[model samples]
Target chain A: MTSPWAVIIVVIYFCILGLVVGKWGKGKEKGLNEFAVAGRSGPWWLIMFTVLATWIIGSTYTATMGYAVMSGAIGIYMAMYSVMGLIIFYYIGPRIWVWGKVHNLYNLPDYIGRRYGDRRLAILVAIAGFIIGAPWQIMALKTFGYTTTALTYGALPEVAGMAIFAIAITAYCVYGGMRSVVVTDFFQGIICVVVVIGGIIACIYAKFGGIGPMFQQVLAQRPEMLVIEDTKYWTSIIVASFLGAYCWLEIFNRIFLAKSVRDLKIIARGAPILVGTVYFLVGILGIGGSILASVNVDLAAAESGLLTIFSEVGGPVLLAFAAIIIIAAEMSSIDSQIATAGVVLARNAVNEFKRTKLTEDRVVKLSRWIIGIWMVMVYFLSIGELPALIVIAIVTYEFLATMFPTIIIGALWKRGTAKACWASMAVGWIVCGILQISPVTQAWFGGWGAGITGAFFAIIVYFAVSLASPKDEKVEALFAEVEAYKEAR
Target chain B: MGNKLSRKSKTRLGFAIYFVVVIVPILALPTLNRLNTAEPFVGPFPRIIFLMLLDYLLVCAGLFALYEIESRRGDLL
Candidate 1:
């Protein structure tokens, strides 16, 4: 059943990507800045693509696509939440970038550490972020397996496929670090935009005669696909993603990677249009996908929409391309995660733990080793079956949502104290952690997510303690520094 | 019109506009978040899909407007 041509095609694609990425990512290993954040000089267009590529992980295609197939247009709520997140980041992110640029920060927790002038709070945030973030890496690898196995027509076992990517991604990230990830992201993002999204639109046009006719069938035959079954679930998930905009460590680094605040603003204004349009087109593909499949299958139901569309369209070349783009999307995300974890471990955990007097190069070297080990460990863990991939994704989102209240208020409000930061973050993280693992998903509380409900406590405590708590004397200087940076620019 | 407004009032207005943009779909749930009742074909889509499309376009446009205001005021960073 394995297609010799499919393996040959994917291998050829990888070879080309490897060569291009190697060239761009070369000479970037000389400094930690190049490795961690691409020396903080990414243009607006590259930042826009890389940010979208990194955010739209494999589960986005698989799980979110599956939701769209089942729930109809309501499934586009994933894209909506992301749009909300980007918009929120539009306002909040540039200010954080100002602080980051001044302090030469790489990670989200690093900003928190510097903002509160508390190294320990940074450590607390980093450790929690790492714990919650690790599951996503695992989940993506499982998707890597599913996509590879399905695409290759069983040419290779899923474990072999996962191993191939785990090794390949680890090699490049270790070699070129962030530069390689960003370079490869441009490739992946392009294919995603050109091939994957383009292919979907082409399917509706060529197969169904046009978009209108395709939806006419959906309207006429699969009308239930358009109905909103759980409106509350829809509202809650979008709100959670909106609030947890920057909880993602990769997105946090993307903000720092922008060339300047203006470039970031351009990105904030422009990226939503591009990415939102991509999702809108892809969302339209879902209705068509449902028309192609039996409507009432489970969430992880039937073969992927792309697979069915391409296979039915009788294009092996197109099917292979879609599979590769999906795989490339997975690699883009996992590479960012591995790259971030390595840097955070080196800067926040290793150096801060002992207050090590190590040189910056030494720290960078340490991170390289950590990146290798982290990937190896995740690779080994990824070889197992994980039917709960979507569950892990949801729980991870809830955990990261806990970081929102502290991150926003800490960056915005002058009265925010290091004391209040710890209390509120601790309370939010603990309560959200409990609620995420519990049976219900805050079903009774206006249909919001467990994470947002838990964050309700975080919000109250943040405001209450912020009002009563004594301010850190350094906070005024920090605010002054921000103002001076503003005036200077 | 822009020069007379204080930054605090501008921020409050920004938040008010943002919440409305974000929640407009929720308001639509009672009416538009249903099957293709009012019209079966809103061009290429069912009525609901068109509304969802309008909702996110609103989101993108609304947020960009806020960003422009902040950019003009030198408050983006």
Candidate 2:
């Protein structure tokens, strides 16, 4: 499994990435605005590509194959979440982008804090965002580390592999800020599309003797996978994923970076087709993995299904290329999460405590330092034995989904006071935590999913509390401002 | 190019498409369970597979058409 050529290819890949960092990293460290939002000048195509690339991460590639192997065609539903999420975004994202542009918002917390005129609620958002977002990044990095180590036959220790990934991602992201992340993401996105399509074609031809025979093998053996089940578990996951789209900080943050609301609209329009097609192709490969497993191809692990197929069908060179694609997906996602965490730390958390206003350069520097520190923490966490990638990803989505009510409802409702928003968020997390850990609830409604349960409770609490509580004049004014903006447009 | 709908109307249209193309098919999963039989639609492809593929194509086409119609208004973009 180990190949010196793989090592060589990886080293050269890192060098090319370093060159990209060097090119885009210049003069981007001067201000918090530049560091966090790319000066709000990203074109439509870059916005679309970066968003697409960030969505297609380790979970999409690794965990998805794992799901397919375990449950058959039901696995594609996991990938379909992103497609549904984008469609949901198409409705709400443009308005959020307009609000971000008008208010000069840097992150989600900034939006919530300003909308409610409550700094404490903003800080709460920042802390919650950091907690929910960081674990997923750790999961992505761990996936990259484990996959790379496995591919190289353990020539590099798992911890060391994770450390290398963390260091490289942190270096570029910290140095170049949002600009480098987006730029590198565009490149990564293109590579992901090409590799996924190429890998699918290769697997279909080499492994299954083309699409006809491929479907035939799957149909003849694992026919149950093709059947769509209507269990509460499946419905809950689909619903939560659609609602949870609003909760992903990285995806939400892209709204602030678009050159115009029109850019976001364009992205919303095009991303579903593009991302859907890519995942469909990847799903085909996952089906091929199932066929290989049935014939006793000795898959190393469930999550390694896609990689194993690539290695077997395409040989060492394609294996090496597939390894790079995994790296690309991991870096494209984890870097964005790290960068957003840095922004929250610098802008929302630290600035609240300092007496004097920090210089723009100082703020940017603090952000970079925060990114470095966060990545180190994630690297250490990645080294440990972690849960299944699908579990980790879904759990992260659940916790973040708790914030969905406060965000989406707050944007539309004038009665949504800061106190209610805070209380709703707290209640949501408590319910989610209880449902996730309690054996009784797990037995009763495990299929219903803790995330959807939390979201459902949070939405009710948000509406009930907001209605019962006194309305704030500030919120009313904010609503007026939103209306005025719409009228002007 | 000639279509001219208000933003409100366009929003309604978008939601309608979302319901018809995405939500309805998902809600129909229970009824569609009958199609899950192993009978091959084409060269050993299960009938359910073709149904899902058609669902996917419908979604893509629906969303694209929504975008095209909205873009023609020239006000929202």
Candidate 3:
């Protein structure tokens, strides 16, 4: 399932093209607003595309397909949570936008800092966010490296794949910041969906004839996978993923990029279609790959199993597009992470800690430098790759999942105090981390205990601590102001 | 009959629809879809995949209606 050098060249060409598109999208704004959130006047289309591009990460191309091949319909949890999450956001997003708009909040920790008037909590969460994103960047780099090597049939070294995309993404992220990320996402998102989905169709047609026949073949050979085997794990994954959907710094930042609450509503209405299509294609590849495993077991389980299937059937031409599309998706993801990490570190955490706050220009300069530091961190850490990258991704999601109670409650409940948030996150992080051990997760929870159960504990601790603590009048007034802002809008 | 519903009622209805959409895929669908594990094929997809697709479509239509309903001024309050 090796592709020719032509695929490698095409991938490189497209990466350069994406940089040009990103620079074009970067516009001429110099302030923090323009640099961080594309001036917060992003049209519905820009926000929609950027969200989709970031949402469908490299794993959806790689590991999720392997999961689908291993277990039937399990990856639907991936799709299910995404759509269900919108149900929460459709209601919650506007209020977040209102809060962000009203207080000039830059990111989620900034919102927390203002909401509770607690700088330490904000700094802790900000630092935690930057830390949580570490494994994520490594995972993305590994997936990038794996897919390029697999697609090129070992012509392209794994390190080269990681280095190529990481450098290009970091360059644009440093140069243009959020504006470049969103603009390039708009460019890459289109190529990703069209090429990846089209490649999926080509693979199905080349192999199992189509999705139904592929499923029929699998059902005839191994029907166990076709049915939901473990209901508890399945439901738990869906719930955890749904709760965790908006917990990412990039996701929270994307809400602020929307032009209006009306645009947020539009995003809510439209995202299920885009995200659903992406996941739906992943489902087809997974089901089809499940059958392919009977023919080629080892390749079927490879991290690039999905793209390998495309390369095997759809051939080098489709593999080139596949390589390009994945790079597009990966850059869309990594660039956002780098941009947000840099901004949060500089503006949210560093400036707050300073005696005299850094000027806006100095903050932007510091942010760019932080982006470089983050890329270096990825380079050093990813040198020793994790055995199971998706596992790291799940752990990354778990850390963010612990923040669910703080975010959802902070937005809605007036009584939610800073003390409650600290206690809630502490309990949630420890529970989730303990449950994450491989043997315990497998024996006790069947697979997905870390996130959903951890969130359950965090929610309880948040409520108990909130009820026990004296209600802060300042907090009550903050909620009143949030409500007033919503009304005035 | 639908036109007679007030804005308050419409928002409530929207929330109810959203609640159902969330509950189905998250809580109900996996268990319910497993009731028939014979793996029937439905329109180019297996039964489980078909159910997921159906659930996804329901969210699309349901959310769009909610958007239309909530886009109105009084519907949110």
* Residue runs of model 1 more than 4 Å from their true location after superposition: A1-3, A294-303, A387-389, A437-447, B1-12, B15-19, B27-40, B66-75
Q: What stretches of model 2 exceed 4 Å from their correct place?
A: A27-29, A294-300, A355-357, A385-393, A442-447, A469-473, A476-489, B1-10, B13-21, B32-45
lDDT against the true structure, per candidate, is 0.76, 0.75, 0.77
Highest TM-score scorer: 1
Q: Candidate 1, after superposition: displacement of residue A323 in Å?
A: 0.7
> Per-residue error at A37 for model 2, in Å?
0.5
* Per-model TM against the reference: 0.92, 0.90, 0.91
Of candidates 3 and 2, the better by lDDT: 3
Lowest-sum lDDT 10-residue window in model 3 chain A:
A294-303
**TM-score of predicted chain A against the true chain A, for each candidate:** 0.94, 0.92, 0.92
lDDT of 2 by residue, A407-446 (tens): 8767766788777787888898898899877737855654
| Worst ten in a row by lDDT for model 1 chain A | A294-303
For each candidate, the DockQ is: 0.50, 0.38, 0.44
Best of the candidates, DockQ: 1
Clashing pairs in 2: none
Local accuracy of candidate 3 as per-residue lDDT tens digits, A1-489 = 343564766757675776566558676868888888888888888889888866798777766776777776775667877887876677677777877887788788888888888899988888887877778788788777877776667877988888887787788888888888888888778778887777788778778887777778877887776777677777777888888887788877888898888887898789888888888888767766766654337544644666567667756776677777776777788888889989999998889879999988898899999898879779767878467765676787876788888887788778899999999999998888888764466456445568887888899999999999998998777667755866676
Clashing pairs in 3: none
lDDT of 1 at A454: 70
